[model samples]
Target: MKLRILITLSIMVLAFGIVSADFSLKWFYPEASNSTSSSDTFSIVNYDRMLYGATAGIYNLPDVNSVGSDPDDYLEIVLGSDELKNVEDTTDSSQGVWRCLDAEGNLEWAVGTGTDESRSSVAILDFYGSDGLPDIVSGTTSGWNVEAMDRFGNFLWTFPSPPHISGPYAWHSSPAVADIVPDISGLELAIGCNAGYDSTDNHWGMYCLQADPSDGMDDGITYSGWSDYPTAPGGTDGTDWDTIWFHPTDAPVISAPCLVDMNNDGILNVVFGTGWQGGIGGSLGQPGGKIICLNGEDGSLLWEYSTGGSYPAVSASLAAGDIDGDDDNEAVVGAYDGNMYFIDGDEDGDGTISGSEIAIYYHSGRVYSSPAIADVDGDGDYEVISGIGGGHLKCFHYEPSAATVTLEWYVDLGDSIISSAAIAGDPDDATPWLFFRGNVERTAFYSHTGDVLQIFISAMRGDNAYLYQVRGDGTVMDSVRIGEASYASPVVADIDGDCLLDLVITGANASYDSLFMIDFPGPDTIWCFGTDISIHGCETTEFHPQISNVYTEGCSLVYATVCVFDDDSNYVRGLDISNFGFLEDGTPIVPPNLEMINECPPETAKVDVVLLFDFSTSMDDEVGLMYTHVPEFISALRDVNYRIGIMVFNGCPTEIDGICNMVKTHF
Candidate 1:
C-alpha cells in the first residue's frame, strides 16, 4: 500500500517601535591623569564626569577611594608614578600602587612599594585611625605582607605570617574591608593570600588575616600582632599546596583571592582561585582549577567547588552579584581557557547550590580577567559581563524562573579587556546604560541594543577609562575619557551633591599614578522614556460557494472558509462552511434535503449534525419521494425550506435532460 502525507506551514510577523519619552544628558568636571583602568565613578547627585587615565609609558597607579562625607563631597582619586629602568635591554613591566584623592583633585600624599621582583597585586581599604586621621589598609605579594599607612603616606604597621607557616610563593589576591560593628562602631579588615603549592612533593594552601587598626607596628610585625583566622579543612596537609601547576616555559604559579558577599547576609565572603600555572603542562592535572569559599569573620570554609577535568580554565579575578534573582549572590569567575562560570550561592549555608556552568564564551586564548554583573536592563535581573583575551565583551541574563539564560549582546573592542564592566542608572528605567574601557587607549559607550554611541580616545594606548550619561534607548548622551593604559574598572558615585552622578577611574603611567576629578554641571534634564502597547487582530467570517454535478437527479455543491488573526489576540476573522454536497456510490445526491442537510458553523464554535434516510420501497416508488421524505426523515429541519430538489435511479445509467427543471416543476 502507498500513502500520501500533506503538510502545511504558517509564519507569524511581529512589529516593534520606539516608545514615547524624552531624556537628556549633562557633563560636569572631568578628572584627568590616573593609571589605566575600566573603572567609573558612582553618584549621590545628578552630576558626574570622567577623569583622565594614566599613560602607557608611566607606572603611575591611581585608586578610587571610598565615598566620604556626602555622596557629592566624596573622594575622587589618588595615584603615584615611577619610572622603570631597562636592565640588559629588557624593560621591566611591573604593577604599582598609588594613593586615592578627594573630589578637589589635590595631592593627598602618595606612596610607592615593590622591589625589582615586581608586585603581583594590591588591595586597599578606607578606615578611620585611632589618631583621628583617615587611614588606609593594603596587601600585596605572596609573603603574607599586609600593611597599614597613615594619611601622610607613613607606614604605621605591617603584619607577617607565622614563623611555622613558611611558603615559597606570595599572595596574589587583594584584601577586603568590612565594618564588623553591629550597627557602626568598630571596623575590621580582612586579607587572604595563596599558600598552596603545585608539585606532589610540596603542597600549597590559603591563609587569611584579621588586623586591628589601633596597633601600629611598621617593620617586622608578627602574627601575634593580629588575630589569626583558621584555614580550610585539609588545607594544612602538605599535599594541599602540591596541586599548583607551572607553565612549561615560564613555570608561573597560579592562585588569586576575591572578596564578596555571597549570601546577601550583610557579611563579607572570601573566594580563592587555584589551578595549574598556564604556559606549562597545566592540562595534565586532575581538577586543574578549584574555588574555596570562606566566612570572612573566622575564615571558616563555607563551601568549595573544584573543576574536575584536565586543565580546567581558571581566572585570576572574581566578582559577585545576584544573577538568578534568587536573592542569593552568585560568583562570576573566569578561566585561563576563556570560560566564564556563574556559580550560585546557597544563602542558608545548607551545602545545596547550583554548580558552575560555562555562562560566557570560552576563548582558546587565556582569560585572566574577572567577570562583572549588573542589571544592564532595568528589569531587576542582573546580566553577567566579562571580557576575553581577544577583547570581546559578552553579556548574559539568567531568568531563574524559566531555567533559561539569554545572551543579551556582545562587542569586540579589538584589544584585551582585562577589566570588568560598570552598570549604573535608575532601577526603574527599562534599559539602563553601561560603561567600560575597551583598552588602555580608548573608552567606548554602548546602548542596550549593542549600538556604539560614542568613543573617546585618551591616549595612544586607548582611553583607559570612561564616564557616560546614558539615554533610555541605550544611547550615550555624553561621555569623557581619562588617560590611557588602564586595567581597572570604573566606579560611580555622587562626588558633588548636584543630584547627579560622578565617575572615578584608576590607571598607571610611567612614573606616578595621578587621580583627576571632573565635575559635571547639573542633572541632565532631557529624558527619553518609552512605552509600548500590544495589539491583536480580531477573527471574523467570510464566504465563497461553488456548484458542481448538475443532473436529472440533483446538483452537488461545496463551500470553503478562510481565517486570519493578528498577533495581539484582537480582531479575529474567519469563514464558515454553510454549504456542501454528498455522494452515494459515485452518484450525485442533490438538494431535496437541502433544507434538511447540515450546515457548517463558525470554526471557533463547536458544530454537530445527524443524517437520517428512509430506505422504504414505498418512498422509492414516488419520483420525488427522496426529496419529500428528506424533511420528514430529519425532524431538526421542520421550519425553513432553503432549497428543495430530488433525484431517482434504479440500477440503470439513464441521463435525464433538464434535471433542475424537472425537480423545480415537480416540487
Candidate 2:
C-alpha cells in the first residue's frame, strides 16, 4: 500500500509533474470549481477505487486545506449523502472533509469527526485481517490514538483503548504497519508524536502497538516486554494495558517516520525526524530536528544524525535507497537551513554513521522539501531532487563511492519552496524511469518502458501559486495556475481506475477545502490487466464483460471470464452463473459459463516466449503493478507471436513473494 523506494524520471518545477485541471475539467466535487476551501494539505492514497486523504494542508500534503484547530481536532465535510460522522469546527469557517472520491469527481464516502480530525497521513492495509478486507489506519492531530476503521467509516479499534492514555499526545504521525514482531502473532503499528501544539515544555515520542489486537490482546495494545526505551502506564483505570516501547524525543516529530527493512531482514527499522519547538538547550537554540533510526523489534535506536543550522528542523521526511548499487540504503533528507544530508545507512558494516559515513549538499535556502531519488539524465545512476527556500529547485547527482553529492542543476522559482518533489514516468518516454533499476527485486513496474517524469511544487506566498511541469532541461513542458496558492503538492494517480493515471490536488484561497482530480491528458494507452478475462467462441449474443484475450487450451470445453466492477471500479466477486442469465442463438441455450466467445477463431496468433512479467510491489497497488505495464508486456508478446498467452509471473522482475521471502513464478 506504500512505496519503499519512490522511482521517478525527468526533472521539473517543484516536485513531480502532473496534468493540471486547466487543460481538462475532469472533476471537482460539489460540482463547482470553488465550492470549498482545502486549507492545509495532507497526504492521500487512491486504493480499492477510493481516495483516503490525510491532513492535507498543502505543505507535501498539509498546505492550507483547513484542518480543525482544537485540543481535540474535528472536521466536517459533505459527500453524496454518505456522511462519515461529520463534526464541525468552531475555528474553521470552511467545510472540506477528508474524502474517498472516484476519478470522475464522484464521492463514494466521506468521513469527518473529532477523533478523526487533523489526520496528516493514513496507512491502508488489512489491519485486523477481519473479513479479509483492507482497512484504513490513520492518526489524528490531538487524537493521540492510532485509529483503525473500515472504508465504510466504521470505527474498529483505537490503540491504548479509550480514556486518554497519554493525555492526548497528538498523533500527527501516520501509522505504519509491518510484521516487526514475528513471534507476536499479528502485525505491529508504529507511529510518532508531534509538537502536540503544546505551548511550552512538552515531550514527544513514538509508539509501537499491535496492528491487529483481535488475534491476541483485545485491548489493542501490547509490546512484548515494552522494553528497550521506556514504558509509561497508559491504562487509565489500571487494567494493565501496555505498548511495545516508547522512544522519547525532546521536540515534536511533525514528520512521518518511515518503516523500512533496509537490509531486507525480516525485521524493520523505523526512520524518522523531529523539529525544535523553539529550541531546547544551548544559547542559540540547538538545531532541534534530527534523523533517528529505531530498531523495530524493541523500539531501540539503530543510528541517529543531527542537522546543523540556526534552527535546523527536519519538517520534511527522509528517504532511503542504495545510491551506488551497494545493496544497502542511504538515508537522504533536507532541513529548514536549506541543506540536504546524505547518510550512509550503516553501509560500512559498522552499524553507525560517522565522519565519512555522512555527506552534505546545500540548497542555499531554507528547505521544507523532502527528497525524491530518480535518474533524470538517464545516466544510469540516480539523482536527488528537492526544493529549498529562496524559491529554488535543485537536483544533485549521487556518487555512492565518496558518499558525496554534486549539483547537477538548480532553478530559482522566485518563491519559497516547502513542497517535496515527486517522480513518475511521462507517457511519451520509452522507459518509464524507475528508482534503482539495478535493484530488480524492488521495482513494481516494468523498467525501460516509460520515461521518468519530474514535477515541482513551489511555495509561493501570494496568487502567484502555480503548478509547473518541466522537461529535463529545466524548461517548462506545461504550466498552469491552480487557484491562488497551494502549499501542498497534489499527486498523479489513476483516480477513476481508467487504466490511465490522473492528477488529484487541492487548491488554496478561494479554492480551499476542496479535493479535485484532473485527468492527465495524453496518450490513451491501455494496460492489459489480467482482469480482462478471455472467453471462448467469441460470440456476440451472450453476456461479455471486457474481453481482452480469447484462446483455447485444447478447443474443447468453453471457458469464460469477466472483470466485474461496481460504481467504484472495484472488482466484483462472489457471483456465478446465477448472477446473470445466459442465452445463445435466440433459443436461450442457457450457457452456464455466462461469457460468450466468437466461434473458434479461424486462426490463432503466434506468441513467442518473452520474459514473465512480475506484478509485485509498486507505488500504486490496488491492482497489480503489471496493470500499468501490461500494455508493453502484451505488445511485446504480440510483436513476437501475434497473441498473448498465460503470463508467467517470474517476479521482476520479481515483486518479491513474502511467502518464502524469494521471487515467485506461476502460469
Candidate 3:
C-alpha cells in the first residue's frame, strides 16, 4: 500500500518534538474489508464482503471532525437488497437526516430507506456541499444505485440509478471518482453496472455522473444527470455526454479504473478491463476479455487490446507507471489467461495504442493480484512484481537500454496466492523485502531484488502456525511457532523505535484474530493485544518518554516516529520504558548515549578559515608544507559549515583571468 501523509495534528511542547509510541484501538466498522481506502483523507473505509447487504462506514482520522469528537464514532450509510434504506448517523445516534436520490434519480427521504439487493461501493470526494470536509459517494450492485453524502453521513444527492442486473458476481464493478471534465472544479463519479443477464436491456458498461451537485446549502444536486453505455440517442438524461462505449460481450468492468496520464501529455485517461463472465462463485473459465483505454474528458475510446485467450484477460485492477523511464507510462496488469502484460501508452507518440503496443510474459498461473512497481534490484529502473494463483511470486525486469522486458526470477510456493505482495522497507537500502500470503499453508517472504534465497515462510497448520526465517544463502536462521493462521500481508516497519524493521502480522484463523509484532534482529516476540481482525499502522511522531540531552544553557530534545497500532477496542496504551530502552540487537541505549555525550555542537556557531599564500618567489618548500596540513585542516572543519578564503599575491598585484586578486576571497 502507498503511504500518504495527510495528518497535520501537531502536539507542541517546550522545544520537545512529539513522538507516537504505541497505537490504541480507535474504532471498528463491522463487515468492512481493508480492500477499500478513503480518498477523503489518510483514513480507512470498509465495504461489506458478505452477500447480506449492510451499511458502509467512514472512519475518519482522530480530530478530523468536531461533531462527534470521539474517535470511535463513524457515519453509517445504510444499504439493503430489496429497498433503499435511510442514511443514519450512527456516531451519536443523533437521528440526523438528509435527502438522497431514489433509484429513479429523484430526491427522496433517505432515512431508513432500503433498496433491492445492494452492494456497498464507498469513495470520498470534497466537492459536494458547502462544507469543506469530504463528501461520501456510494453505489449498489443490485439496484444500480449511486448516492452522495456529506462527511457526517448526511444524505446529499444521488444520480439516476441504472437498471439492476442479477447474474454472476463478475458483473459488479466498484465505482471510481475522477475529475474527468477539464472545466469542472470538483470530480466526476464513474461506475460500471450490469443490466442483468436475463433482462432484455443488456446495458452493461461504464457510466459517468457529475459528482458535485450542491449549488448552495439550500440547493442540492442542481442537475441530476447520468450517461450510460451504448449511447441512448436522444435520451432523457442528457445529450451532451459523449458516446457510451459498451463491453464487447456486455461484460461488466470488474476491475477498478486506473486514472493516469499515460501518454505524458498532462491529460488523464481511464484504463480498465472487462471480465467476470462464466459465473461468480467460482472460476468462470471465461477468456478473451479486453482492457480498454478511454479519454477521460469525453469518454471517447483511445485504444482497446484483447486478452487473446478464451478466458478473461483482466480480472485484476491495472497499475500504471513508467517502468522503462520513458516519457509515456506503460499499463501493467494481469489476466486470467495466465499472462502479465506491459502495454505501451504511446508507442509512436500518437496518443493511441494498437495491438502491437503490448508486451507479455506468461506466469503459468492465473493472476488475481495487482502488479506493483519498484526498483527492487538497486537498479535505476523499476521491476514489476505480482502474485499468481499458482502460488508463484513473479518478478519481471525492465531493461530500459535494451528495451527488453523479461522474467527476473520467480518463487513457487506449494499453494494458491490470492493476496498481493506487500513490498516494504527502505528502498535506498539494498535489503528491502516483500511479504505475501500463499494460501492454506504458509506466508512466504523474499528479498526485494529477487536475487537472494532468503525464504521466511510463516506456516499455519490448523490452529498451529510457525514463523521461519531463512537467510539468502539457504541458511535457516530461526523457526518459531506462532499460534494462528494469517491471510493478510505482513507489514514491515521499525515499530518499536529500536531502529530495526519488525514484521507485523494479523492472525486470521477461526480461533485467533490478533496482531503479532515480531522483532527483527533477535526475532524477539512481543504479544500485546488480541481479537482484532484487521489493523493499519501509520508513521507518527510523539515526544520521547525519556532520554533528554541537558546542556549547561539548555536541553536538546530528540523525537522519532515509527509504526504503531491501537488495540481492537480503540484504546491506545503506552508500552513500558523497558520495551523501547534497547536496540534491535539488544544493545543498551544508555551506553551509546554516554559514549556520544559531546557529539552535539552549539546551535548558533559558525566557522571561517583564512589561507595566506605567496607566489612572488615560487616558494615550493612553504607551499608543500601547507599542502601537507591542508587535508587535516579541512577535515577538522568538516563537521561544521565552514568557509575557506585564500589571499594570493605575487609582484605588485596578481592578475588572473582579467582580474586582480589583491584581497581575501571566499571560494
Candidate 4:
C-alpha cells in the first residue's frame, strides 16, 4: 500500500484595534438636593437584580444627625426582580425603553430614608432570606450601627440598639461577613468600631457578632462594654461576643477588614488597616495605623506589614486579586504614606508576605482609596486603578515577576479624589473604560490605554452635571445635564434589561440623593473569526520511488521501491530515472542501474553450473587457465549473490537413443 500523507503550515496574525471600541453614555438621573454626599461605591448585587449604595460626606460628625445634617444620605436599592421584556421590532431605531419605575410608580426599596452620612459601604451576601433572595448588609460610619435587611427593605436587626454613639466622630467599621465558624450554618459579620473611650484598655478591639438570618436578634445578640469579655481589660467583668479578635494597635480599629482566602488553601484570613491620621506626616507614631493579616478560623497573627515610618499607616481598605493569574492572591493597598503596595498573600506556603514578594509604587499624594484591579488592556493581566488626594487617577500594569511594577498612564482629574475608581466593560470584548469622580468639577471616563474617551466637564459658572457621549477616538459626541456634585464611583449594569449595560451612580452633594441610572443604547456585542488551515496531497503526479524503510548509522539511508517499465506494457514506457529528481543537501541524487547496485535481487540463485572437461585432449591448457581465473572469479562472486560449482570427466559419452548421456562423471 502507498503511504499517503501531506503537511500544511500556516501562521496566523492577530489584527490590532480589536480591543478599542466606542463606549458612550446613554442617560443619567440627578439628585434632588445639594446637602448630601453619596460617597460609597454602589454594589450591583442579587445577581444584578439590585443596586445598593450609601452616602457619607462630612469628615467628622458627632453623630448621624446632629445640629446640622443632610437627611438624604440613606441606603437606596433599585430592584428588577421580574424578568424584563423588550420590543420585538428590529428595524426601529429605538427598539426598547427601560422600565425603571415599578408598577406603583415608585422606585423599589429606599430604606434608611434620612440624611445621615452612612459611610459604611454596602456588601451583598449570597445568604438568602425567606423570600429566597439574597440580602444586603452594611454598617453606618456616622450612625455607629451594623444592620442587615432583606432585598425588599425589611430591617433584620441593628447592632448597638440605638445605632448611634455619643462621642464625636465615633466611626463604625464596614461589616465583613463569612461562614467562618465550624458549626455555624449562617454567616458571622465582623466589624472594628472606633468608640474611643478615655482609657485605651477599655477599647477591646475587633467585634464579631452572629448576624444569623433565621434568628436575627433572638439569638442573644446584643452589645455591651467588656460584658462580652468576662476576663475584662478594665477589671470590669463582661461577656465577650462569640469571637472577639483584639486589634493590635491601642487605638480603635476604624479601617474595615476584608476576609479572603489569602493562601488559597481553602481557609480564609482577615486583613485590615487602622489609623485616624489622614496621611503619613500626621499619622507618625500614632500607634493606631498598621496593616494586619490574621487567621480567619481563630483570630491569630498571619503576618503584619508596616511602612516602617514613624506613622506609616494603612488607613485605607485593602483590595485582593490574583493579578498575576498564578492562583495566588495579592493584597492591593493604598497607604497614608502616599505609596501603593502589592503584598503576596502567601509565599513558601508559610502564609506570610515575604520581603521579596512585596512590591510598592508611589504616587505624588497620599492614597486614601483602595486599588481597583482589572484587565483594562485586554492583555490578560490586571492593571491597578487608584485615585489619589492629588486629584490624579493612576493606572499601573501589575507585573509580579522581577519584583517590579510599571506605571502605564495617569490622568489629572483636577480634584483630590478620596473614592476608589470603578472599571466597566468586558476585556473579552476588548473594551474596558474607567469611571471616577473628581470632586465637584467633573465625572470623567477613559479607555484602558490612558486615552480620554469622554469627559463630562462640569459646566461653567453653574451647578451643572452633564453626561457626555465619548467617541472611540477621544472626542465628545453629545452632552446632557444628569445630576449635581457626584463623588461616588459609577457602577455598570444592564438595569433596563435592554441587553446593553447601563450606568448606576450617585452624587456626593445631595442635589440628587437617590441613585441615578444612565440607559446605555450602544453596542454591547463584539464579533471575531478564528483562523484555520488545511492541505491535500498532489493528485495526478505519482511518485514511483516510495520510501519503504529508513535505516541510520552515522548518516540515514532511505530504501525505496525501484520500478522498471517493460516495452508495450500497461506501465508508461521510457520512464527516465533522471526525471526522478531526488535531492540531498540541495544536490540531485541519481539512481544507479539494477545490476550495478543491488537494486533488484532474486530469491534463489546458483543451484548448479557444472563444467565437464575431456582430460585426454587439450585439457591441460584449459585446466591451467581455469585454475587461474576460477579463484578470481569465485572471489568476485563472494560479495554478489552467486556461488561456484565444478565437475571433471575423463571418459567419452555413450549415446542412448535420443537422450544425450554423459560417459563418466567425476567429483
Candidate 5:
C-alpha cells in the first residue's frame, strides 16, 4: 500500500549535552485568514484554539503549540451556507460570532448579529435554561438590540421586541449580571443604556431584569423592582423593559455596568459612567456625563455625581475604593474634561451630596482611561492611578491636612492611554523586568535574541553585584555575588569551546575591572562534564560526529554519512566514524551496513600478523588449501601498514585462539 506517514525523530546526547529534534517543521501564517487581530485582544477557546476577529469573518488558529499548522479548515465550511449552520454568515457583511468546538477547527455554532451590528464582547453564562449549557449574550453598539442564545445557537430572547436600529445608542457597554435581590433566588442583568445628547432627552437609562425566570414556565425576561410598571403605571399592560424600574441618564452610558455592594448592604448595586464621543463636540460642545450608583434591587438612584467643567462626555469606566481616610468606598472615575474625580458615595449625612463632597485632580488632557484605586506601592494607604489623552499616567492620594488631592508621580508612555492597568499578586513581592523596549510585543520591536522566559538580572548590594537566575516558575534557583556592582543583566552564550554557556556581566559601579567573564553553570539542565568525552574512544567534545546525510541501498539497506564538527561549525579533519546512531521514528536502526568510503585513519597505526598452519606430510591436502588463501589474506591488508610472517607447525594445533598466546610467550 506504500504507507505515507508523518515522521518524527529526535537526537539526544545526554552525556555531551546536545539535544535536538532531528526532523524539520516550517511555520507559516495564511495571508487570507484575517488582516489584523481585531481592535480587541484575540480570544482563546476550546483547547488552545485562538479565535481572531476582523472586519471579515473570524479566523481560528488551531493548535497554538504546533508549527506549520493549517488554519483554513473551517474557512471553507463557512461563507458557503446560507444559515452558516456551523461557522460564519453567508453574507460577508453579517460576519457574526463563532465558536471553535475543537482544535481541528470544527464549529459548535455561529449566530449572525445581522448587518452592522457593532456588537460588544459576548459573555458566556449559565443563565439560560435547564439544558445545562452556557448561554451567549451580546448587546449591539448604542441601544439597538441585545440577544441571548443557548449553546446550540437557539435564540432564547431579544430585548425590545421592536429593536432600535441606529442612533447615538449602545457603544461598547457589556451586560453585567449579579444577584440583585438579597432575598430573591435567581440573578438579574443590569444594562446601562445610552442617553441622548441633550440633558432633557429621555428613553435611555438603567434597566434591571430577571436573567432566568424562577417560575421556569416563563420563556422570556421579566423586570423585577420596587415599582409596579406592570400593575400600577398601566395595570398589567407593558412590554419587555417595563417590568423593572427605570432611571434616566443625562448622556449615553458607554461603560459596562459594575455591580457590587456599594454601602456594605446585603444587596448589590450598579456603578457606571455616562458619556459619548470624547471631546468631539467642538464648537457646540457636548453635554458632560455623570457617574451614578444605583440600587441593584429597585433601580433607585443611590448617588449621582457630575464632573466639573462643561463636562465633556466621559467614555471612561468607573472604579471604587476607599479614597479618603474613612473606610467607606468612594467612586473614582475619569472624565473627558481632563480630570480624575473622586466622588464620596455618602457625604454630609444629607439626602443629596452637592459641595465639598467631590474632589478633582487635573490630568491636563482628555482622560478616557479609567482610574484604578489601589495600594500600588504596597504602602498601607491607597493611591488613585489614571491616564489622560496626552499620554501621561499619574498617581495621587488624598491629604487631610491640605484638604485636597496631591500628585505622587507621573510618567509619559509616548502614546495616548485608553486601556486600564491590571495588577497581580502582592505589590511588595513583585520582581522587576525590563520590558521588550517597554512592553511585550507580538510583532517584536527588535530582532535581538535570548530567551524571554529565562530572565537574568543583576543587583547591586553594598560594593558587590549579585547575578541571579529568575526562572519562569517565579523562583530564584541560583545566585552568585560578583566582586563589583553591575548596572546590567547577565549575558550568556557558549563563550568558550567547553560547550557550556558562559556569563559576561559588565560592571558599572566598579570596585574592580569593567568586565568579568565566568562559566555560567547555574540553572542549566545540560552540562558537559570532564575535559573531553571519550565514550567510544573519540574526542567527542572537540570532535562530535553528526549524521549529515541519509539514504537507502538496494531499496532496503539504509546508509548514513556521518561527519565530525567542532564548536566553530568547522569540519574536524582526520577523524573516522567508527560508531554512530540514526534515529528513525524515535527508534535507532541497529547494525547499519556502514561503508566508510571517505575516511582518513591515523597513519601511525601498526599491524603485525603471525600465521600458524599444519605443514606435515600427512596433511598435504590441508597445506595446499592454505597456499590458496595466503595471497588473498595479504591483499586484504593493502590499506594497512603491516608486517606478516607464517609459522607452519609439524602437526595440528590444540585450541582455536591459542595462536596469539603462543606467539606472545614462546614465539
Candidate 6:
C-alpha cells in the first residue's frame, strides 16, 4: 500500500513539471563586460528547437572584421546544431537576411543573395517554393538577387534581375515575398527600387518577379525575368525611391506596396499605401503628405486621399491586414510628422466595399517607423503596430461594424523606433509577442498583455546596429546584429537543417557595411522562399491642387496650349488640348488653335490658364469633364480663331498638349 501511494504522487509531480516547463517564459542574458551594454539588439525564431541572435562587433571590440570597403558582422542560426556563427569580412556589404536554427543550434540557414561586398539587403521571406525547399531572395544596392539552398547551404539556382548602378547613388530597397499560387507555382517576389537620386528626380517604384525552380546557376544569376511595368510618375530622374503603393493617394512617390489576399481569392493581390506627398520632404513648394493607390498588375492608378495640411517633414511607411474581422483588409500608414492613419473599406478588392473609408487617425508627434499589422488583441482582427520617432510603440484597433478605430495600448522606449514591428507565435495562442528596435540603442519585446518581455541594449562607441528577431513565445527564438548603422529592417529564417529559426541583418558600421546571419536553436524546422504576391487593382480619387488657379494680368492671348503630366512630369495620355475645353464661370469658351500658340499675340488672350490634372484612374470623372467641356466650347466658338491657350501641369512639366493660337474669324 505504501509503495503504490508513492508512485502515484511521483507521476502527478512529473506531469505538473512538464506542463510548467513547456509553457513558462524564460529570459537568458549572456554575461558581457560591464562596459558593454547588451543593447544592440537582434531577433530569434523557433522552428525545430533552437534560439538565435547576432552580436555587433566582437566582445570588448567595437568594430567588425569583414571584407571590401564596407565590412560588418553577421550572425546566423545554424539549423541542425546548437551554434551561433558570425560571418565577418572587410570587403562585403552582407548584413541583412532571415536566419533559423535547431534546438542545439547545430543547423542554420539564411535567405538573401548578393555579391560578397556589393548587394546585401534582405527584406522578408517565407516557405513559398513548390519543391518545399527553402529559397532566399535579397535586394542589393544594385538590384534584386535570389538563391535556393537546402538546410546544408548547398547552392541551387541563382535568380537574376536587371543590372543596376553600383555606387553611393545606386541601391535597391528590400524584397517582399509571398505564396500567391499555393501548392503549385512556388512563390512570387516583389522588390522596391529608387530610379534616381535627389528629391525632385527620385523615382520610387516596385518590381514583381515570379520564381522558377528549374534554373540552375551559381554565378549570381536569376532565371526569373522582370515585368516591364511603367515607372511611377512624379519627381525627376528617380531618386528618393522608398516603397511601393499599398493604399491610395494622388502622388506616386507616396505610395507603398504590400501583398495580401483581400478577397480570399487564391491569388494574392498587392495593396498600396496611400496619403502624403513627396517622401522625405513635402510636395514641390508645398508641405504635407498624400496617399495614392495603384493596380499591382499594370501599375495603374486607383484611388487617392490626403492627410490634410503640411506634414512636419518626414517619410511614410505602410501596413495592411484584416483589422475588423470583417473579411476585408485595412491600411495603416505612418508618417515622420508623428501621425498614423487607418484606412478601411474594400479598397476595390471585390468585397463588401469598393472604395477605402477612413477609419481613424492618430497623431504622435514623433517621427514614425514602418507599421506592423497583426491581431495583437487575439480577437481574430488585426491591430496597427507602430513605433514613433520619440521611441514609443503603439497599437490601434478597429471595429469595422462600428466604423471606428481606437487606441488599444502604447509604450514609450525613450528612443526612436525606426524599424517595423515583427510578430511571432500563432494568433490564437494564449500568449504572443511583438518585436521592434529602438534607434541605435536596444531591441525590445512585448507580450500580448502589453507587458515588457525583454530589452536588449547595445554598447556605445562601437557600431550603430539594427536588431531583428522572431517571437517563439516559450518555444524557441533567434536574433542578429549586422552593422553600426541601419536604415533597413532585419529578416528571420531557419538556416541550417536543424528546424530552428535564425536571423539576418544588413547595415553599415564605421568600418564597412555587410549582411550578417545569426543562428539560434529552436523546436521546429522553418522553411522560407523568395517570392511575392501580386497587387490585383487600385482605387483613386480626383486630385485637387491646393493652389490650382493662378491668374496673371497682361500675360498672353497669343498661342496657349494645355498639357498633362503625372507626378514625375511624365506626360499622361488623353491630356491633349483637342480633347479638352475651358469654361469661364460656367460660360463656355471656343477651342483655341493649340498649334500656333507661340506665334499668337499675348495681349489677345490676356489670361494664361493651366490645368493640373490628376492622372490616377480615380480621376476619370475629372478627365471626362474636360472632354465634355472642350467639345461644347468648340461648338460655341462659332469663329475658327480665338485668343486663348491652355496648359497641362503635373509634377514639373509646363506643357503636355501643344501650344495653341486662336484668331477670331467671322463671315
Q: Estimate each model's TM-score.
A: 0.47, 0.59, 0.51, 0.52, 0.46, 0.45
Candidate 1 positional error at 72, Å: 12
Candidate 3 per-residue lDDT over residues 1-667, each given as its tens digit: 1122222222211111111222222221211122113353211211212121212222221223343332222222222221222223233221112232211112222342122234433455465654566666555544434556664445566444332232223224445666665665566666654445332334545665666644322111222232433331121232122222223334656565666677777777777776654222533323336887777776667777777565665756676666665666777778877888778765575655554676777656666666666554444456676666575666777553344578877655435443344343231322132112211001122223422222333434445444444332323444444434323233332322223333433322221112323211111111211111112222332422211122111111111111122222221212111112222133432333222232112321111112223344333323443344434434443332212222333432223332222232211
RMSD (Cα, Å) of candidate 6?
A: 29.6
CA lDDT of 50 in candidate 2? 9
Residue-pair clashes per candidate, as listed? 139, 67, 41, 25, 8, 200
Candidate 1 local Cα displacement, residue 334, angstroms = 1.8
In angstroms, the error of model 3 at 223 is: 12
Global lDDT scores for all candidate models: 0.37, 0.45, 0.41, 0.40, 0.41, 0.34
**Per-residue alpha-carbon lDDT of candidate 6 for residues 596-639, written as tens digits (9 for 90 to 100):** 33321231322222232323333333444444443444454323
Better of 1 and 4 by lDDT: 4
Best by lDDT: 2
Model 5 bad stretches (over 4 Å): 1-87, 92-109, 130-133, 151-154, 162-168, 195-201, 214-243, 278-286, 322-327, 354-356, 398-404, 425-667
CA displacement after TM-score superposition, residue 317 of candidate 5 (Å) = 1.6
lDDT of 1 by residue, 308-426 (tens): 33455353556665566566666666666566655666544665444333233345555655555554544445566656666655666665444445667755554555545544443
Candidate 4 per-residue lDDT over residues 316-406, each given as its tens digit? 6676667777787777777767788877765765655676778888655656665666555444456666666575566676666555778
* Candidate scoring better on lDDT of 2 and 6: 2
TM-score of 6: 0.45
Ranking by lDDT: 2, 5, 3, 4, 1, 6
Cα RMSD to the true fold for all candidates: 21.7, 18.2, 17.2, 24.7, 24.2, 29.6
Estimate the TM-score for candidate 4.
0.52
Question: Which candidate, 2 or 5, would have the higher lDDT against the true structure?
Answer: 2
Candidate 2 Cα deviation (angstroms), residue 587: 56
Q: What tens digits encode model 5's per-residue C-alpha lDDT throughout 1-667?
A: 1212222222222222222211111111111111123462221110100000111111222232132233433211111111111124444333233332322223434555442233343444466555555555555533245555565555566554333333233324556665675444555676656533344555456666556643534323344321322221111113343334566676656565766665665667778777655321232123547778787777778787776656566666666654555655666677777887766655554545465666777756666655555554445566665556575556678653234687877655424554343221221111111110111110001111121122233444454545444322224435555433332222222212233333333222211112333221111111111111111111224344444444443322233444444555554332222212322234443334344334222321211112233334444433333343434434442322212222334444233444324433332
Model 4's alpha-carbon lDDT is 0.40
Cα deviation of 148, candidate 4, in Å: 1.1
